[model samples]
Target: MTLTVAAVAIGLMVGSVTPLAFAHLAENTPEERLGRTMGNAELGREVGDAGGPLAVGAIAAATSLPVALTALAAAGLASGVLGRVALRDDGRVRPANPPG
Candidate 1:
């Protein structure tokens, strides 16, 4: 029951964030390459989805489940921080150009 609840919570969080992430990507990406950029982003997401479980399983096999889960959580936190830092805007005003 706890695992199910956690899974549902995580799913909700991912569902909420995904559209925002894609919207940000679309906003920052060039119009000509938007499709390709989205495609690549989707591919990367799929790869990560597949790899994350394998990573956790490997770590669990080597150490313990608790340690593995902690490591995964830490890694996720670090990734979020890195992405936030990388995507932060340097204070500069620019005109908005809407895509046709």
Candidate 2:
């Protein structure tokens, strides 16, 4: 029950945030390259989706499940921090081509 609940919560969070991420990317990317930017972002997401579990499983095989989970969680937190820093602004993503 707990696992199911956690999974649902995670799904909801990801589902909600994904659109926002793409919207932000669209806002920052140039009009000419928006499609390519979106494609690359989706590809990166697919790679992470596949690689994250594989990475955790490899780590667990070498160490332990708890250690692997901890490492994964730590990596997630670090990446979140890095992204926040990289995208820091006045609560808005400025357009790549602002209107005159």
TM-scores of the candidates are: 0.76, 0.73
Return model 2's CA RMSD, one decimal: 3.8
Q: Which pairs of residues have clashing backbones in candidate 1?
A: none
Q: After superposition, how far is residue 95 of candidate 2 from its true place, in Å?
A: 5.4
lDDT of 2: 0.77
What tens-digit string does per-residue lDDT give for candidate 1 at 1-100?
7556655655665576667778999998877889999999899889878998899899989998667666766776687778789888889865565455
Candidate 1 lDDT (Cα, 0 to 1): 0.77
Per-structure clash totals for the candidates: 0, 0
Quick one: best TM-score, which candidate? 1
Each prediction's whole-model lDDT (CA): 0.77, 0.77
Indicate the worst ten consecutive residues by lDDT in candidate 2. 2-11
